[model samples]
Target: MDTMTYDYTEPVLSPKGQKMRDILADYITVVSHRLPDDVTKKLVELSKIEVDPLQRLIYDTMMENQMLAGKLKRPSCQDTGALQFFIKCGAKFPLLSELNAILKDAVYRATKQAPLRHNAVQTFDEFNTGMNIGDGIPSVFMQIVDDSADIEMYVYMAGGGCTLPGEAKVLMPGEGYEGVVRFVMDRMTSYGINACPPLLVGVGVGTSAETAALNSKLALMRRVDSVSPNKNAAKLEHLLEDGINHIGLGPQGFGGKASVMGVNVINTARHPSAIGVGVSTGCWSHRRGKINFDSDLNYDLPLNEGVEL
Candidate 1:
């Protein structure tokens, strides 16, 4: 793949646009250090369920690590991962014209200010960009809406352990949805623990492999407490969660009662001839956050309510 061909445009920002970039830098810093509310709450719940003495100790250490990261203002993990942004914005957004530039600068500034580990290495050259900006770095996926002025953004760090190489396949018409379950089980049992277990599994079912792969990652942006709104999808979520947890991968894959915080499935109507299924996982640390901005750029960090910046 020629990463240079990725359509990431850079534009000069106005004074107001510069300010938005600064705010986004701050948002990245906060997200990098603080676990989002839903993820934190789920971690607490899982900690209580863990009965193994070693696993209980592991949870305690995990909480301590999170607390110290926030208190000291540092990344929760050394890897810090690759920056990925999922954005849904109105075409009328105040910053729509400058959104891409702002996001790119946000990553650059966050890399320096947050002191995030430089993880963007030139694929063929194997040379680190050091600034966290390079060809295709800080990937931004956008969905444009009309007749509104709000923007919703999801920020995720594709850590070394999490963001595992996802699996996707198109099942034949006769295979049926049961094949989807079987595929997920195969992947989860084989590699889910390797992603630093107590994972959040995101499964996507759609008409084709590409759509399934995209939806799988998007599902990771949802609140950990949320289940699929679709009845069958919700049931699959429960069954997958139950089945994976029964494997005893536990916190950090050290072995315990719970292997995953939750399993979420996002689906679209598939073609009559095929069912495409994909799976992705988030590690226990789960460094992801969601925020909403109004026309004026005044933002609401629903996942970080008490966070001022």
Candidate 2:
């Protein structure tokens, strides 16, 4: 019998490109171990309102887990999740052509350095790729911006538990916004507990299932405390937040005063006959990070504080 050995060498690149890749890899490692600033703050706020002994204990355990993850330099959760990047890049950015390859390489490096769990399994074939890189794994969705020379990215870990409750459907026009609320509430009642409350709920309204699904994910990228800018949408966010909190699923699904950190809604115009709504949830950890980079590779991580990568 022969044993196969794998090579984990970093990919060759221009000096600048190599630097950018290294930075991204380091950033991913940091993200794995640390909760974003907004998420941490929201969790603390929720902890204050919990009156149940068990729910309060759960919140305390969550905070301690975060502290130990950062202090010990390891992932906060066993499910590091499938990496996904949502990016808005300038058409004129220097590394636009190489960005895709750079991102893939960065994940590969992070998988080894962060020791991220192998979460990318090939569909139908049913085998974990082990590298966290498979066909379309470390999913990157990009939009090119005109007249700009910078890039903004949201890095998220869509864990199995959190992604389990995701759903989308098209409602009849006659159902109106009320229908949208009904769909979301149904999902929360049926599956929200599996996501690990207090969850950050993202709601998307659009013309079709795919659009709504994507927008729902984008909504997850927003800060937990953020509200939609559109007046009607903002009101819907508040309404959903109130309704979901009313579920009383509480922290870790034990009963308490609140069940969610916040609810975010993202909406766009839809066809006259149909309204599509999608839901995505982020667990209490809510490991979503935002980073921005200039054409020169100068970078800032707005969601993560005191992180230098």
Best candidate, lDDT-wise?
2
Q: What is the lDDT of residue 195 in candidate 1?
A: 92
Clashing pairs in 1: none
For model 2, what is the alpha-carbon lDDT of residue 49?
87
lDDT of 2 by residue, 1-309 (tens): 543333345567788788888999998998898999999999999999877689889999999999999999899898999999999988888887778778889999999999899998878767677898887888999998676999999989899999999999999999999999999999999999999999899999999998899999999999999979999999999999999999999998998888888999999899999999999999998889888999888899999878886
lDDT (C-alpha, whole model) for all candidates: 0.88, 0.90
Candidate 2 — which residues are off by over 4 angstroms? 1-11
Candidate 1 lDDT score at position 191: 86
lDDT tens digits by residue: candidate 1, 18-123 = 8889889999999889999999999999999988799999999999999899999999889898999999988888888888789888998899999899888878
Backbone clash pairs for candidate 2 read none
The TM-score of predicted model 2 comes to 0.96
Model 1 residue runs over 4 Å out of place are 1-11
Q: How many clashes (backbone N, Cα, C below 3 Å) per candidate? A: 0, 0
lDDT, model 1: 0.88
